[model samples]
Each structure stands twice: as structure tokens, then as C-alpha cells.
Target: MITATDFITIPYTSDLTQAGIAYACRSLPYTYDRMGGSHFNRLRRIVVGVAVELAFRRRLAEEKVPHDNLGSTPFTDPDRYDIAIGGRRCDIKSFMLTRRSLIRHVSREPQALLGADALVPSDQIVSDHLNDEDLYIFAFITALTTPNQRSLDRALKADQPIYLIHPLPKEWAHPSRWIPLGTLALKCDTSHAVTLELGGQNESRAFMAEEIVLEPRKRAAAESDFYALGYLHTSNPPDGIVGVHSPSVGETHLVEPIQWGNIWIYGMQIIFTGYMTRGEFRQRGNRLPAGSRVFKYSSTRTENRSLPIAELHPLSDLFTQAKKWAKRGA
Candidate 1:
């Protein structure tokens, strides 16, 4: 049985370095195109995979457990697994828990077929590539809902737990191609038939009558205190200052600015940063000098405060410093 001892925790830190940020800004446009246009949500999903993989690998290394990382292997390869431990192939499946009690299905396909016997057996849909000898590890992580930069920074620094389940038998594994029971019974168009190749024969099937009722099962698990891993920050400091802002009070407050890159760090944990058009800045609130640009420090929060002219750095200087830092890191 999988126990608490089997799990490992990996810390999360801001990986944004001067060079990394510079590279990201330069290449993100091309990368987004190559990833199929501006699908930020899709890109975020891929990043979660990367984070989980890295955390697992780090834990293995720390425990002195010998394992081979096979993530670079092509997905089409039958032997592809996330890691190999003691010659046992282990595949990692990760999902995000949006709420305290639920996890939505990852599969986008319909779950049931159209007929008197509409429930599709789970075994038929399981991938043939997964060998019987291979073990499955499911990693369920928490999702953050920070609305502002302050909250985001705090969430990133805070220790979040990851629940893991292991050795899930291949026989119990379900296919990602499953449709909702309600959709299958009521909304499915009878005229549109689905073709399936089964047992060396091509079969075309049409939707059943609306009177058919198939109950949908809740795939998510209840809350449990499983083994969890915590994310910690690395030794390296932040790449650059994003911006600077102070809390709004009746009395004027002195602002202290620390420059990192194009952004400024101030008030200890808060980062001052954001871009706005000259017209928008003037029309919305206070205006700076005619040639000067204005950047909102607390853009993510409801309370707004403007940086004093003396505390503000020229945009040109920030870019130059960022370039220098990038080269130094390189």
C-alpha cells in the first residue's frame, strides 16, 4: 500500500532571472505562435507539468534514490515513462484541485456511447502502450486564486501541499475519452453517428432515445491528509525591480525604491510595476511631466498610489541595466 513515507516535497521559487525574463520577453511571441497562437491557458497547463516534474526529480535526488528521468522521450514511444525507480517504470499523472473537495476530469471526450447498453467499459479505452509492469503515480496539486500582485507574491512564497497516490493498477485506469451522461442521453444528435473501430471491425453507432438515463459518477476524491511536499525559495535573488508603490494614507508618505531590472522593489515584499498610456494616466488621475512616462506600482490592487518624480527611474536606464544583468548572468 502507498504510505506517507513514499512522498517527497519540492519548494517553489521565482525562477525569473534577468536573462530569463529578457529571453522570455524576446521569445514569448514566437513561442506562443509555435504553441498554436495566444492560448495562455494552454501554456499554463504545460507549465504545471514542468513544475511537477521538476519537483519529483528534485525529491528523488535529495533522497539519494537512483532514478532515470525519461521526460525528454517522445510521447509516441511505447517505453516512455516519467521516471524509473529500481528498474520499475513509473508514470506521473498530475491534476489541479481547484476547490477543497473536487477535481474536474482531464479528458475532454465523451464517456458513454449511444445504445441500449451505453456505458463504455473503462478497460477498452485504456492506452495499449502502458505495460502491465509499469506503475502509475497521481499527483494532485492545489490551485491559487490570487487576484493581485501582492497576493500572488505571497502565494508563490507560501508552502503549498501536493497529495500523491501510487501503484494505481493499470486495470483500474480510465480513458480520457468519456462524455457526460446528460449530454449522451439528452443533447446528442441522433443524425450524427460516431464511428468506432473495435475488434478489427468498423462500427457506426447513433445516439439513444432521450428517455435513457445514465447517471454520471463524481470522479474527484474527498479531502484527505495525504503526504505533501512544500516549495521553498532558492538562494538567488529576484532579477530586477518591476515597480514601486506605497499604501495610500491621509498624510503623504516617503517612498523608498530599490531597482532590480525594469521593475522596482519597495515596502519590503511589494513590487512596484505596471505600464499605462500617457493619455490614460492623465485622464484617470495625476499627470507627470509632458515627456515623462507614468507606471502604476500597485496595479493589481484596488488602492492606488503614484510614485514621486524623484523616486522614479527612466525606462531607458532600466532596460540598459537589465541587459547588463542578463549578460553578467550569462
Candidate 2:
């Protein structure tokens, strides 16, 4: 769904190695270890950012455009701006595209005041780097999804035909378009930061910002090949496990015990649930079932060592009822 207009294509010219990329990832504000990727997502971002800067520098040199690569000096502070052109400091913000749109964490703090109903902009929303920079340049890069496809991976592997890069519209420079940093509602955890709604009902279909499709390597696969039964400890199920739509199956599958570990008895029935890989769970938009707190068994521990079958309730009974209803409708 990506189009040529969405990017500002640049040729690969940097000699930056993967080790350098990994080092930069660690140096950045959100360190690589905390970035929640099973592998490589953060590294890709760092590489792409450096590539864009290098490419921009090359283009400027060829055209005799005046600019200072602040990053070039031996004494250049890591805190200094990326580049200075025509006396204006420009900082490059790079993001990876998924489902044809970019989803980035814009602020460390909420955009508005916490615990307040009004949407007034917060003074703390501005960072020291943002305040010092005269202009912000955003670069969007595409991650390779298939084995034979052309992508940023090609550039990383030193293959021909590197990944495509694009610059967002000039309007993004405006502060209003920036993703808000604050909570969507009061009392929610700070980790639940706000995001910008890029498209609405009337927008063109091709430009909509859909759910991010994380690459296989970037996600953790299911622990075991087979599914098992688990028990739901609480009567209330989590929002994602309870009502969210699953695009893969075309219909929401009732929360079934996919993997079993610990057993809990509620009334006369044993409530069972199973382990879902972080990848599969993220497909449900990263929601966890409500009673996740009560079920603390590790996903890596596949065998149910202690529980007896006599005390465990069968999940097949619920699945059988669902199948019977489907046949009657048919």
C-alpha cells in the first residue's frame, strides 16, 4: 500500500556498520534493551537515521549546498544537533513504516495536564533538544517483510537496491500534528501513552494508518508448537481477549484455552486458559486477559507437572457447544 509520494528516496552511501548501529541504539533516549523488540527493530531505526543523514550530506555536497555536519567533529558532543544548514539547526527523526503509515512515540510526558479534562497543551511537552533545533526532518523507512523483497535489510546486508526513504509533508512541522504524550484517560498507567489519529472516516482508504505489522524476527514466536488448556482465574476477562476483533480469522474466536499451565477452580468448574506468544497476543493489539495477574506460570514451562486431570475441567465442552450452534445456523 506504500506509494512513491510517501517517501523522499535517498541512495545508500554510509559506511556505518551494524555494531555502530547497535551502539547508537544503546545511546539513544529509549535504550535498545527496553524497546520490546525480540530483535533488530531498534537497530534498523538507528541505521536508517544515520543513512538519511549521510545521504543528505552527500546530496548537499554535490549540489554545493552549504551545511555543517555537526556529527563529523572529533569533539562533537553526542548531545549536539545532527546538522546545521543555512544557519538553522535540523534534527532528523526517523521512524519505520508498517501497514503504509508511521506510529511513533512522540513525547515522554502527556501532551496535556494529567488528571484534567481539558486538552490544553502542556509546557513540558517541549524537550530541550526540540527547543534548540530550528527545524525537524522526519524520515520514514520500510522494513523488509519477505525473503526476496527489496528493503532496508538489503542495505544492511550490503546488497544492491537498498530500502526506500521518505520525508513526511511539511505540515508535520506544526506542533499540533505531533503525537500527544499524555494518557488517554485519567488514572491510566503512564506507559499507556497517547498516539496521534492520522486518519478519520472520510480519509482516503490507501492513506489510513492501520495496525503495525511487526516482522517475524522482530516478534517472539509461540513457545511451543501445540496448544494447551488454561484456566481463567477471574470472572472478568480482559478487554482485548474479551471483545477485540481478530482480522486474521475474520471473526473473533471466543477466548479458548490455547495452552495450559496452572489450574484454578471457580465454583464447580475449572477455568482454563493457555499461553499465547507475544506475537499472537500483539495481533490482538497487545491486550492481555483480565485475570493475567492470577495466572503467573511462565510460557516457557510447557508441561503441567502438578495438576491432575480429575480436578481439571475440559475446554472441549464449550468448543462443542460453539460448533453445534454453527451447524444449526448452517
- The list of candidate 1 runs beyond 4 A from truth reads 2-7, 16-38, 74-82, 99-125, 145-330
Candidate 1 C-alpha lDDT tens digits along 153-267: 5544764221111111111111122222111111111222221110000012111111121112211111211111111111112222111111111121111112111221010
TM-scores, each model vs. reference: 0.30, 0.31
lDDT of 2 by residue, 195-248 (tens): 111111111111112122222123211211111111112211112221112122
lDDT of each candidate versus the true structure: 0.28, 0.28
Candidate 2 global Cα RMSD: 30.0
**lDDT: worst 10-residue window of model 1:** 109-118
Cα RMSD to the true fold for all candidates: 29.1, 30.0
Q: Once superposed on the true structure, which residue ranges of model 2 sit more than 4 Å away at CA?
A: 1-7, 13-39, 72-80, 98-125, 145-330
